[model samples]
Target: MSTTEEPTQGTTISVTEQAAEEAIALLEGESMDTDIAGLRLYVQQGGCAGLSYGMRFDNEPEEDDTIFEHHGLRVFVDPASMNYIEGSVLDYEGGLQGEGFHVENPNVVSECGCGESFRT
Candidate 1:
């Protein structure tokens, strides 16, 4: 993976305030019926560009997962995916155009035209 900024010193990823708040809101909504723990962020081998990002609400972390608590929200990242997403900043954006969680990954060398996939 190519990186523009220096990789994070000790962690795999960084979570932004907006992303943290959005994640917490989703978790809280689901927590009304069940106990929710955190969100998991990982990369999978797929997509037109060869890599795709994935996220899901998780009740617990795996043995090899790296966890980060940011702005009162917990985020989990698996060991293998961590290498491709290291130094990435997770953020949430809203506007007239669109609104969603976005990954500002310095490691991305190129991205698909659809913007749903990337290559290192």
Candidate 2:
């Protein structure tokens, strides 16, 4: 990572060290080409709470995507999705609570019971 106090200007999302580590592990474990692969995070219009988060490994960025690098991990977010996830902190939690990437989004006003979606 750059080790800067703040994310670069225009950066809409932030990834924690743990999240970056986990993401890197997952990407590497998949046996994909890491050089051109990145984690894509976005929002969709369907879910119990009206909006759901979608994430996957992308080999290329869309024309309107914004990319951020944290601890050598690349995170891709689309312009529209950026509005709902600005200042969000991405973390990976394991053990009894659960295991996976969790988004701590400040813009969120409500979330579904299952935590799969949120309303901002």
Candidate 3:
């Protein structure tokens, strides 16, 4: 995996090459620009399962966030959600059922049926 040093941060955010490649491919077909800059992974409360994962393409990093690189892709994680997502893998899966990005979160204790939410 490739690594990038954040100009003013100490923590490193890691992303797998497979995840990066999949993100790039998906973004290329979207109305958004392919120059993703990086992806932002965060967690928020309020889902039916108690918590939800929020992701977005971000070109800038927050003051308290850590940045990292993998397979030529950049990943950003907020300080608040970092601990919950640490060691988790981000992947894109597709089949006759559906296609989307899924997070294999070790911290997750349970998930709701809709798959849009989870809890630790």
Candidate whose lDDT is highest: 2
lDDT of 2 by residue, 73-92 (tens): 88888878888887888889
Comparing candidate 1 with candidate 3, which one achieves the higher lDDT?
Answer: 1
Give the TM-score of each candidate. 0.86, 0.86, 0.77
Where model 1 places Cα greater than 4 Å from the true spot, the runs are: 1-10, 32-36
User: Candidate 2 — which pairs collide?
Assistant: none
Which is the winner by TM-score between candidate 2 and candidate 3?
2
- Per residue, candidate 3 scores C-alpha lDDT tens digits across 60-79 of 56776766667766677877
The per-residue C-alpha lDDT of model 2 at residue 75 equals 81
**Model 3: runs farther than 4 Å from truth?**
1-14, 26-36
Q: List the residue pairs that clash in candidate 3.
A: none
lDDT of 1 by residue, 1-120 (tens): 333233457555778898888888888888721223788899998999999999988887776677777787777788789989878889999999799999999989999999999999
Candidate 2 residues lying further than 4 Å off, grouped into runs, are: 1-11
Model 3 TM-score, 2 decimals: 0.77
* Native-structure RMSD, model 1: 5.6
User: How would you order the candidates by TM-score, starting with the best?
Assistant: 2, 1, 3
- Candidate 3 weakest ten by summed lDDT: 1-10
